[model samples]
Target chain A: MPIYEKHDYPLVDVRRYLEPGPVVLLSSAHNGETDIMTMGWHMMMEFTPALVGCIISPANHSHELVRASGECVINVPTLELANQMVDIGNSTGTRIDKFKEFGLTPQKGTVVSAPMIGECFASFECKLANGKMIDEMGFFVWKVIKAHVDKTVTAPKTLHYRGGGEFMVAGDSLDLSARFKPEML
Target chain B: MPIYEKHDYPLVDVRRYLEPGPVVLLSSAHNGETDIMTMGWHMMMEFTPALVGCIISPANHSHELVRASGECVINVPTLELANQMVDIGNSTGTRIDKFKEFGLTPQKGTVVSAPMIGECFASFECKLANGKMIDEMGFFVWKVIKAHVDKTVTAPKTLHYRGGGEFMVAGDSLDLSARFKPEML
Candidate 1:
């Protein structure tokens, strides 16, 4: 039998443990200004329309742009972008143009005004699904309109934020599809 | 300069690429019945007060339980429980007792009525923060009141769901703490 022990710890750091998905670059545009911000707090909210929920603090520059524009591009960066992502996350976009500072290529999107980061393995064009909880919770719900992936990189090593400048990159993939129900597949 | 090509893909399966953190077991109890369900679709929503957002489909039995009780335990399971986690996820708690069948010890939580899985590395007692979009969005907002983590394990390997039955285990951690501003530390 395995023994478990309990310890008192700060709950604020729990995000380091439970955040489920990879850190993403949220690019927003409004009034001809485009900015990319590093984001780790987001999740898939629904399946059919492919809704996504993300929490962007009111303090973030991207928050203002996303709120004003009602659209953003979610760029999925690999482990190679770790340093740039940290730089993007650490600095305020209000003071600097992230695209030019980071030397990232911004590609035009077909659906939204937000430009996708060319270095990322995939990008999702999303429109604000709902903004009801934005004022109170800093929560923005987005619905994916179009998705673009680089088919050349079959398996991308994406960075997973583990809080406090730490990250875990995706390793080998294991298949357990046989254990699931047919409907789930 | 890096070249990126655009390829149209199914938007629904984007979770395969973006899922960032560890898969969790959401345990709920209501009407004298308890259920443990495997969940990967969750994200950290806020910092202070520690809010989390999770999408529980209206079809799952645990969803009904969580809705009725307004409280649950978010259990963070390590890679060891990956198989059992899938089995529990595949099977509905409506027909059988998940606690007994999965051989997961049900431990009383300090803040919520739901039991925590003893085998898990960490457990968070969460109370439903808001249910405004329960019907329309299947999204639940939770506030962590109490948390329990196994103190013995310094670095536990956690599982990240990659859609279908594939998972990416939390691998080596990299420290980029020097790159960030002091306040971000």
Candidate 2:
């Protein structure tokens, strides 16, 4: 993963990123070929068994690999890796090895054959929840087996894509007005 | 719901809003009042049966509610409600009337008593799965009874939280790359 400094853009564009959330970077290798792409239509639907819902467009190469291998890695890419993300998001893995094309490194996963990004601050190795595809109408659901983040990386500042040509960097915490509640009544 | 123009800045913080990628959002009702809050740690374990894993933080009122009512609604909020998201995220329903305080509305659910967000685009009413909810050590699992997104609306944006004063908005489609696949080397 490429590294970059922290950012401080205005709060306007940032809300789009926060409410809709980040476009997650996913990678998978099936039949010896690896692919990467950006997706944001994902949600952790459950907690105990660790379930996730990721909407696949039914056309991306990653969708094919995920269907075949039954697993993939959900990696959180920081803004430092912005250009790489755009490149990975736009390119197909059927022709080139995304890991090598984008200079990303891969590591074996603890639970599944799918590999994790050695550089990403956080990553999850997940297997598909079978028969859960929404009949070509909804997102793909997956079961997460293992997840990790770099220990030394103090704060993981990541990139998020909003509607069109808009991106936001994760920012610092701002406490709510302490009196906002007390004054409400 | 406070409807706004396409790009209005409502002064709400996104991180303070409910986040996606499940942890737990407990459903609780006290003295005939009900509310839900974020469960930051969750997993999507299986696809067959469409199950999800979520952890209920001991501190949330909804945790107690989930156990008592045996059901809850997974309300997916959008970037349009980021400011309100923060308001609900930081404050607890234990003391405040979240819906009233925020001027929001709730609707009856199809499968579970857990109320659904009347305004948000997507809502899932779920039933309790047996033998789920990892020991106090992990999280709880739910058997989804019904998942609904406003069919009238198309191309809706989703939200993502990286934790701590940060968020990302999901964007529109990026058609799968038309780049051709090559022969195996």
Candidate 3:
């Protein structure tokens, strides 16, 4: 596993990694117990306050930890962690310590207690901004307070899940900066 | 522009295209007017009811149309329509007729009055499932009632947006079906 050398990233620009819609590893800690889960259902809600909305079903153990702690680290993993990602999704957190099970290093976060995966390219530390929809739909509105990103790794080969164990790898980037209006960019 | 020969697609399986987190074109119609917008902030919320949650800011012209009609078509556009998608996002419907200006054909939807983009690979007709978050967050939860897909276009070159006019194109697939537990799939 490659331990990423990360640096503090701008909160408003966190959407650069997340808005693309890649599968992320969500890590949470509550009552001295830590857990990690693979999440795919998430979207960027706001840019300035850096709000993100995602569904964390009650069926997963990490959901309980996240609900209790009200904080989590959304870690963006690249294709290098595909096997571990699939395994994490398949197995429950209750049965095993995901970090130890997958040989992933847990790095202490700056703003949250939830540990960040050292191998991932980027990790956004978040606090629950709104929990009104949690009971009704397992939806959590998060405000990212801090972000850590590996600046050296541009165009990370992130994995996008398509269900049934199939993943789409991130490909070549198309820069259309010239086409976009100044305000739009 | 290629007008795909689309067939009825299963509503429960709509996540196959959406979950990957591609930039989608949202088409809306209200009264006698129709509008289209490029949207990147959206996610699949459920499978059985085919629930999808997306942020349509009040500032967008499509917001009022969708709010009044309580319906919209979520069209999945491939790389071929990238220019049109950006142009639609840059220009306002109040200033110009998008369909006529862009020269894109609009097809009548079976479940909703919102016209689907003919040049797109797939379209999902949706009705407002929940609107409680509309005022607070411009969030709308939609139930996909009908879906149309081009079966021949396997591995469509979908576009995933990163801020600053950069897009990540969908790449090769990694099928790990054997690794997934049957029940989980």
By TM-score, the best candidate is: 3
How do the predictions measure up, each by TM-score? 0.88, 0.53, 0.99
Candidates 1 and 3: which is better by DockQ? 3
Per-residue lDDT tens digits of candidate 3, residues A52-129?
999999999988999999999999999989999988989974747789999999999998999999999899999999
Please report how far candidate 3 places residue B51 from its true position, in Å: 0.6
Q: What is the lDDT of residue A178 in candidate 1?
A: 91
Local accuracy of candidate 3 as per-residue lDDT tens digits, B1-185: 89988899998889999999999999999988999999999999999999999999999999999999999999999999989989998986484668898888899999899999999989999999999999999999999999999989879899999999999999999997888889879
- List, residue by residue over B1-185, the lDDT tens digit for candidate 2: 63322221121211112222412234445447688675444433344455555556556667666767767777666656666766666686456777787776777665676677665665666666743333433345666666665545443454455444454444433322232222200
Residue range with the least summed lDDT across 10 consecutive positions in model 2 chain A: A10-19
Order of candidate numbers by TM-score, starting with the best: 3, 1, 2
Candidate 2 docking: what grade? incorrect
Best by DockQ: 3
Please give, for residues A43-63, the per-residue lDDT of candidate 2 as tens digits.
Answer: 654544566666666667787
Tell me which of candidates 2 and 3 scores higher on DockQ.
3
- Candidate 1 positional error at B135, Å: 1.7
